[model samples]
Target: MKKTGITLCLLAMSVGLTSVVSAQTQLPNSDFEDIQSISGVADNGGQPYNYEYDSLGQGWISGNPVNRYLEIDHIFMKDTSFTHSGSHAIVMRTDSIGPVVAVGNAGLGEFVFNESNPFASIVFGAPFADRPHAFAGWYTYKSVGGVAPSDGDDRLINGDSLLILCYLTKWNSTLEKRDTVALASWTSSETVTDYTEFMIPFNYFSSDVPDSANVMFLSSSLGYVADFSERPFGVKGSTLVIDDIRMHYSGAGFDEYAELNGTAYTVGKKVVVRLEELPSDASVRIVDMAGRNLVSRQLSDKESTFELAYSGIAFVIVRSEKGTLTRKLYIH
Candidate 1:
């Protein structure tokens, strides 16, 4: 008993020390707070979901709201079972989370049952003009009926499944049609036994969407396993637990620095400050630290090698037909 007590004390001390180090480093999740929550069906005619606080105090089992809400009794993994109607939607209140997703309901068809409600679904993690860089969670379907319905006999099965998506607010408020960005995909066969990690890049994102995306929706796309179709879909009779749905600002994907090829020019001769990759239709202006334009030249496709008798720290702003890229060089 004395040894166990010592071990516990040591562990607590270690945690304290680690916290101090993290505080100095300004790491993420330091002052993090769970800002927004969407679960267990608020009384405002909202979606139904279940919030399961795990033993580790880091997870929740919830349903996607829109269809049917269900409760599981601990037979499967994560949090027992999933409800389809709940549609497992939660809006995180992270300061640096992502370029968020939005919900739109513009041109949805008329609702036969509920005339006021045209459609019901949510979008997740679409970086429109406002937030062009986004990241989101992944889902995989694992029911018995093999994801697709044959004769429309209730496409969802009694097994296990997962749905993951984000809401881009390209549509109106009817909830019928909206644009979506699929970050990663997982089906029961792909993620169950061998699934570990997935990655999504920003260059592959579509840039034609608008900038009014602010809400996130996670609904079962009808009964389909992967809902890539831009129509209204529904999810019911299952549960999903989402954790670590975050965004990463990868520093502009490529090096913004202009490569100055020193080998192309001879050092013996005093040459002008020139660049080979300067755009043909660009205006190149070389300036000193005091904002004085020392040399100005109209560039072309060919490498421009000029004579620069002066040598110092200089700035080169190249305005090309494509865009403007700036760089600094030390002329020795």
Candidate 2:
């Protein structure tokens, strides 16, 4: 159905500003300076640097082997004396230390071991409530080969690529569990020599603000695909050094009327359309393909729920002095 005449004016809309968001929050131990044991130290030297660590302190979590791949586990994550800024920097590697090198390679995230799969679900995320414009960090990648099509850089693993994933999830009342509200991923080419600063931009999937989030940093992209049965095709000695990671947020200070998330809404269900203030002349109508009006109603209030008894295809029209907006919806 063609929208003939309409103007959807939202009068005096008001949107609340969360706050001034120029401040950037640095996550705990983001500098890779704090060192704690994810896996208890095998040997205690003395005090501060007494024991070796497979992981670090703070909320960071690392996946360490439980004796299956002990030889490869310790080398995967080493809190070495190497300093990007302070006493230590985190080093992750697909080292050639095990029977099958790079098989039990390491990555870090906020996760834990799963009961069904002892070594699975390795990294879990922490609660990150806000969305950042960019994720800024410093990292260096050193692998064997080039990141070219002809140069053994398959998406899976070859020269060994580094991956960092940041996810924002929320508990959905309908879904009954936490779900992903937004995500940002960073994949590095395997040919970086000096420590380079990186800025990863987020491509948000949903407009919904997130609840808890998870992050994953891996030295090799294909380390655990075979579940330690065999090594991945990535270079054995690939290494990633990282430090000084932080989240950057910027928000515009303003107020505006709430617009629909999209033009489409699922039919036969209560769909909430938000409005800060309703226009006095605002009107809504649903029409069939034959130009017959199915329902016509005056809209009021900051929130309105719409539902239709008719099934099949229809065009929902909202009109005010501003203009008309036609939305095609499939009713079931």
TM-scores for all candidates?
A: 0.30, 0.55
Off by over 4 Å in 1: 1-115, 121-134, 137-144, 147-163, 167-197, 202-210, 214-219, 223-239, 251-332
- Model 1 reaches what TM-score against the true structure? 0.30
lDDT of 2 by residue, 136-162 (tens): 677777765544333444644345566
Number of the top candidate by TM-score? 2
- Residue 2 accuracy (lDDT) in model 1: 6
Task: Score candidate 2 by TM-score against the native.
Answer: 0.55
Model 1 error, position 288 (Å): 52
Task: List the lowest-lDDT window of 10 residues for candidate 1.
Answer: 5-14
Question: In model 2, what is the error at residue 142, expressed in angstroms?
Answer: 0.7
What ranges in model 2 sit over 4 Å off?
Answer: 1-23, 37-54, 64-81, 96-112, 119-123, 146-158, 224-233, 251-332
Among all windows of 10 consecutive residues in model 2, the one with the lowest summed lDDT is 1-10
Q: What is the alpha-carbon lDDT for the whole of candidate 1?
A: 0.29
